[model samples]
Target: MTIIETAKMNGVDPLAYLADVLDRNHDHNISRLDELLPWIGHPLP
Candidate 1:
């Protein structure tokens, strides 16, 4: 499924999800990467 569809299925607003991921990607910890997945349904720590 497409990112928009996946994000929605996971209860995230598509645009906001993309924006947060893009914004946090550079500095986010690689070990905790799973936390960034759409299914997590929470903001970055």
Candidate 2:
């Protein structure tokens, strides 16, 4: 829910952002998880 709201606020596609983050979560650095935020994600057009 928050993800959707935040993504909307940032003009991002929530589904794409969530998918990308989930795919990358394993290899992503825990300390930098903030970089993977939905609002900061690069969505496919």
Candidate 3:
């Protein structure tokens, strides 16, 4: 719920946000996790 709400607050599609984050998370650097936040506007690869 928090993820959905935060995405909405940032004007991002919640489903897209979650899907992208989950897909990237497997290979993303944990130390730079903030880059995955909805507000960061990380483009889907």
| Best-fitting candidate, scored by TM-score | 3
Q: Rate the local accuracy (lDDT) of all candidates.
A: 0.86, 0.77, 0.91
lDDT of 2 at 10: 88
Residue 44 CA displacement from its true place in model 2, Å = 5.2
- Local accuracy of candidate 3 as per-residue lDDT tens digits, 1-45: 999999999999999999899988899988999999999989954
lDDT of 1: 0.86
How much does candidate 2 score in TM-score?
A: 0.77
Model 3: colliding residue pairs:
none
> How many angstroms is residue 30 displaced in model 3 relative to the true structure, after the best TM-score fit?
0.8
How would you encode candidate 2's per-residue C-alpha lDDT over 1-45 as one tens digit per residue?
987889878888778777777888899889988888765555443
- Score candidate 3 by lDDT: 0.91
Model 2 spans > 4 angstroms off: 41-45
Q: Please give the range of 10 consecutive residues that has the lowest summed lDDT in model 3.
A: 36-45
Residue-level error in angstroms, candidate 2, position 3: 0.8
The pairs that clash in candidate 1 are: none
Model 3 quality (TM-score): 0.91
